[model samples]
Target: MKQELTELLCRKSFKYSEEPAFKLVSGRMSKFYVNCKPTTLDPRGMFLAGHLVFDAIRTANVTGVGGLTFGADPIAVAAAFASGLKDQPIQAFSIRKTRKDHGIVRWIEGDLTPGQRVAIIDDVATTGGSTIRAIERARSEGLDVVRAVVLVDRQEGGLENIREHVADVSAVITRDELVEQWTATARP
Candidate 1:
């Protein structure tokens, strides 16, 4: 499953260059770029990602899975769906980038309550800033963030950085793995 997902990402989402040509969210130029939405939104990609992420957190005893919106949304939903299919039944939640000012104002939107155990997820971790923010917001809302998961680790210390907040941190795929698969497929 991992192998298949890697190939799909390499073909549909991962991009590479001999020189740093891609601008990251952190405003840094990178030789590699990955926009997982193209892959994560696809049926097969969703299936692979759902199963993989669910496998990663199924035993963590978390009642919910989620993270900052947009990037983490699809993966979280997919994982939650996979969990239900597998009979684990974890809920999916989304954290807003801006605080809601309306009635029942909160940073998160889901069927979760204060103190519910949950895992934070992200599509890509570059500086771990977004995931860290998600973790902080989750904590602020009184959710117990026990684990963090990255769909793709940029291999640029993001996971290491995330580990500081949550001891249990993992990535389904690394930038290196995508690069390797990309290189292999690019060749004759």
Candidate 2:
């Protein structure tokens, strides 16, 4: 089941899974790019990943799931839906790159209550800067961010930085493993 979940996520995240010279949001030459919308926008991929993520966080006992907007949005939504299916629906939220000037004037979105345990999600992690900011916003709102769940970890310093605060992180695949599998299977 776990292997199946990983395979589907790899196939669906084609932007990163198939490309090798993606220009990352960090302005660095990423070995790959992870545009998870392809998967999130697909029903099968979303349901599979949602169930897997929810089960993964079962031990974490998280009250909410969220992270930086854009990439993490779909994953957070999926997890929240899975939680609902399990009859333990969890709150979902997001962190914007910058706070909107009008209306809410908040950097963080969703129900912003204090002291909730949360798990952060993202499509991919390379430097962890964005993830860190998300964590900061959540913490500032008094959310106790317990762990991070990423679709892919680029096997760079990103995981290290996140671990400084989260200690334990979950990912569907690492850069090394993804390349290894793709190389072995990608048709010529």
* Maximum-lDDT candidate: 1
After superposition, the stretches of candidate 1 with alpha carbons farther than 4 Å from their true spots are none
- What local lDDT score does residue 163 receive in model 2, on the 0 to 100 scale? 87
Error of 1 at 112 (Å): 0.5
| Candidate 1 collision pairs | none
* Cα-lDDT of candidate 2: 0.77
Model 1 whole-model lDDT (C-alpha atoms): 0.96
Cα lDDT of all candidates, in order? 0.96, 0.77
Best by TM-score: 1
Q: What lDDT is reached at residue 175 by model 2?
A: 75
